[model samples]
Target: MYNTLLLLLIIPTLTSGQPGKCDQTPPQATVLTPSENKGIYTMTIDMKSKNQNIYRPDQTYVLIVTSNDVKRPFKWFMITVEDPEVDNSSYEFDHRSVDVGSLKTLDTNRQSRYSERCYNSVENTDNTDKYRVEIHWVSPKQSDKKQRVRLRAMVAENSEVWYVGENLTIELGKDTTKPLDSPPFPPVDSCNLCSEARYEVIFKGHWSRMSHPRNYPIKPDNNGYSHLVGASHSYKYILWQEGDKASPGLKKLAEQRDISVIEREIINAMSVHNGTRTLIRGKRRDHPYMFEPSHSLFRVDRIHHLFSLVIAMKPSPDWFLGVTRFELCTELGWLESHELPLYPWDAGTMDGISYESATSSTQPVDTVDRVAVGSFDKESPFYQMNLNDLKPFGHLQVRRLDVYPLVGDDCVEGINEHEGSQEQEAGSENVEEVIEEPLIQAIKQDPSLQEDNCALSEWSEWSKCAPDTGYCGMGTQLRSRYRNDRKVYFETYQDQEDFQDGYKSQANMAANCRQKQDGALIESQNCFVDCL
Candidate 1:
């Protein structure tokens, strides 16, 4: 019989917390009697009756269907298998697979009962074992109202599987049918299987005018040419309090880079709706003074959206680069990228005397400090630039692009809208496999094999003179030192024989530091705390 149904489907199917194979007997089925009128619901199953032998072929069958008192939930369910001696059947729901047609809808205000599972097998061809299994239920908001159903059937024969059917309960109340005074509405504690989601907000902008600091301005002047020429971003879902006050449309979009009075008065009065603006087109030495890299796109619905950005570091009077109220849905979910490192804030309303001073600063607004590189000194005009390669000047790639189906109404299709041409074809195939690696062709044929013989580390023992501050007075009692081993030799003839034997040779050390003892291990102790 198909090799006893492939040795009872290769046994080992014991779970309900194990232990079963007929010893704890329970494997039989025959539950008919189930029907409803107006709101449609039906059920039937036989599987050869005669004290329910369960059409053997080394049995294994399970069917669990549920629905209790419905009025607006129970969108669909179906399963049909009219015999000719069946051989296979499968159905599942929620965890997907109801023949993939419709099955993902169960939120009668967060589940009030909905279950499905069917598995039937009869092995090799049809041998007349009499079969029939049909089940269906649909509710267009309870078509004309009336529902109740519950069926549980499980069977597993020798080689194990058993829970044996018949717990069947059915009702289709239009006028009372009884048998369900409770049980079937325990499932509400946030079941958001992705209620609408879409992200994609790339905005990359790196500024440079020989990295800033030459007569600065490229426009907007009274004398001193302020030069950070372009930027404006906006987003809102409100929540910015810290002694609030700053409005006047955020000081005219931070000292005159005007964003239409903060998009009609503070992002349309704290937007939860109308508020969208993102314009970042850098470089301004006058007339689109060219300097590239700038992007923008934003959309977030719920998950407490909030974003704000502003840039302008022109001739200097009102300096800028402020980003407040970030929060792009956290709690481990919606934030794929967020990099901010543009510092220089001084919206104290305007003050200039350098960067070509167009002068203006009656001082007053306060909070000024954060524009460094020794804040332009070497005769000002922004000297030896390279503020850490312009400190990450704003990068915010949020990429989520579609995810809505936890009980669909059809809306969740838009996979990465060409995700920047699939990330520029995966960054040009990872820069052509990192320029054909072999460590970049051995550092382009020995560029001193990119030096790095690595060694430095041998201090250790000297840590007991705490009290640097648990103050009583003068304080300063420190003594600390560590490192008893550090090695690295990327073979190039063992780093040129450990750089010509400057170390590494106790069979190339590192066996507990080959009985320690190397050079440069200074440890000092100079403390003094007497005041009180």
Candidate 2:
């Protein structure tokens, strides 16, 4: 009996450290395939194999595992790179890969799947070695039951690689993306166009005095027209697929008023945005001719952030004004307001006089110039003009239109009143139409009105101050005066011969002496008395 008890004690000690059958189960691994799209590589892991779900909870517990035990299940899956040189800094897994939702498969026919995506980090290297993705599944019940699946990734053509402190580059075979060879432009995607924000673009045209004096005398009757003509505007996102080169569509818009070519090309092309052209206003003779404002709406897209615009100057031979590859949407969101001054550019496709010459040089399209040397020479009527001297010939403005509230009652009332007045003016026949004659003709008829001498009129003596009222402090002292005549005249010769013959005539000049007189009337002393 004593020997039997001793044997039972020995048996308990021998079995205490031994593993159970559940601990002996081995984990199975399935091979996974890797695929790529637009340079991003992905591999999916299925949680089930054969007839059994690998992620299922085992009833026979060597250790208790619950749904809350995320670290235990997550520890089973592992990813490793075969090539040590392959950079994996930018590798990321889809949300499903880490979310508990991925473990719940609704359809028994299909298993739960999780995926990982790999791409080059913002930093790029010259390493050309092939990279591998290894998925390891480790059994929690048994250390010897580990299984793994391996996959090789294929590098896609034209993959984008971002470098630290540098702009992004496209990987084209063995060639790395390089900076543009032309003049330096603002950084790409400086504007966040990939967001869900909406933007509004407003175009305003402000006319200024002719830049060059010789370009004047734009005789409207010479071309059977009345005044100088403006331009029709077209805008579009810059196209990178066409090697970022100027397309025939862009050339057509620059030389002509048609935007159909550009619209069609951009619509047919892949990964690009097309913009519409704005209508042109009629010709005008007055300086600061304000064109009716034009506006457009756009949803920012990823591949197209930089926008360009072209406006063909009418009554000219292939001359235009434009801004190339300008960014409207930025990291700070859509620009509140942006102003662009317009300038003239030679399209180089045709050669003719600046005014409605209707002559074509019939030359192939060439690089745009401000003014070609011999064609629009210094003496030419279309000579290049300085934009600064003209202040703002044309301006562009962009604003966020979605956030503002609608007009209130007072605003609506005012708008209705203004519209009513406009309608009355449009319908009335009593309103006389004034036709303006040419300034040269008026000048010739009044040659005596050529020059003006800045002459000041005499000032009258100050008036007596009024009796002080018993106000809080002291009443304001007052005085007033007027000149005998405010108008003045200067002498000018009629012609070169008249000037040589010392012949001169007087012309009336409108002077601002009245303003000076008013300023002089006010005393330097304080006008108001202190309040009690």
Candidate 3:
């Protein structure tokens, strides 16, 4: 009665181009489960829909569903394996979004196992488990209302796995009101300190030839696992002894542990050869590591001994690749020594030979292959170390330690904090002159001194006088003035043979070479020479 001429208009829900399409159902899909193992595997799913009026065949759709974890605690979903179907027209294809609507409803468990952008390996590969899939309407629709649908399907093995539902009901039925309750998620394994420990498997085998022994790295099998190899050489006794040899009683342990055995010959050359030693000048009179407190400091009287271990690849060593390990023994037990601190240790590819000094202060364990040794000069703090300061078996122990002189005794005050002014004064007064006043003046004029003509040539008398840090060319700077006066020598060559045989004695000379009008040849001959 109140609206005799009233008129009403109703708007229908619209899709991309059509209206009143909210009642349409979406098609189902087929899903496959991961393989049996819990490492890394893949699964596939297929979607199908023929309701052109409700769901367009040309229009693309996304599918997502909840994960089934109660059946397999270790199982995880990998989105990378998804491959959607493309239509005949290159312009159109089916796509899926993982998190929305019914798919979100199914995954209400709230415990997501996937790390953002991080890949996880699936242990199982079989396609027998059920997975959720959702369809999203992405194109611009005529209606303001959004449309989405979801369904669950089991992936068939190998065959064309596809969606299984005739069509998903979009209405808010009793099924929509009651959510499917999923099982609680299991606790993930989280080992903090355990994760820090590096556990590796090594495989050592000939890569190219079988008859000859050689080592090479190979890809892991279907499983993602690799074996590290041990490098053996013939140069050093330690490596030679440990080559291809396992710990004395490790056979049983090897059987129990996850180990990879690479059958290849160690091709390092330094193991099969000997290293040479060299002489280096020290900053102080005594060798750095052996310098006495009362000794004078100068390069002429301090010759540091240095040893070297040169390693080279027989044919050529692969620097970018290859693996090696070290071992150590202690009162507690045997432990795998950490990899040598020499990062990027390589030969042949990097350089044919590698160098290690004896003064390196590195501790020695059971065996050292391709290892180098060296000594420090008097200028090194270790040069003056006493037995008490040198720990023998502790962590600070050095098996092949060496010293090198870096500064002169003139800077002693800067390096040593305990010098007393009173002692300095006393030393200045008591120190006797090694060279006679007349001899010093004569040597200064001639620039050389002969053992026979030396003013002070008696051992007792010379030693009792001020320290005579003899000449560097050919004399024991510390020798008693008369004892083998010319037994010492000097040279810059690093070869061991050059300094071993000893310098030619200058005791027989009649006059100082420096004083002679023409004694250049004699002075040249006095230099230390390499035997070879």
Please give the TM-score that candidate 3 achieves against the real structure: 0.19
Cα lDDT tens digits, model 2, 116-214, are 222111111223322222322222211112212122222221223211111111111111122121112353533323232233444455432343345
Tens-digit lDDT string for candidate 3 (107-158): 3323232222211101113334534433222221121122332222222223
Compute the lDDT of residue 41 as modeled in candidate 2: 31
Kindly report which residue pairs in candidate 2 clash with one another. Answer: 122-162, 191-330
Please give the CA lDDT of all the candidate structures: 0.32, 0.31, 0.21
Q: What local lDDT score does residue 243 receive in model 3, on the 0 to 100 scale? A: 30
The global Cα lDDT (0 to 1) of model 1 is 0.32
Cα displacement (Å) at residue 169, model 1: 91
Any runs in candidate 3 off by more than 4 Å, and if so which?
A: 1-70, 73-344, 348-409, 415-532
Report lDDT (Cα) of residue 35, candidate 3: 31
- Per-residue lDDT tens digits for candidate 1, residues 1-532, read 9999977765635323121111212222132222222222223433323333222211112233333324222222223222211213322111111111111222221311222122211111122211222222221111122322222222222122222223332222222221121111221212222343333333344444444435445553332212221111223333122234455544555566554444343222222223322212222222243233333333343322444555554445565554555555444444445444444555555555454466564456544333433222444443323233234433434344443332433344323322233434554344334321111000001122223333444443333333444433332322222223322221111110001111112122233233335443233555554555
Each candidate's root-mean-square deviation in Å? 29.9, 31.0, 27.5
Q: Which stretches of candidate 2 lie over 4 Å from their true place?
A: 1-185, 189-194, 207-213, 216-246, 270-290, 362-364, 372-379, 382-391, 402-532
Q: Which number leads on lDDT? A: 1
Ranking by lDDT: 1, 2, 3
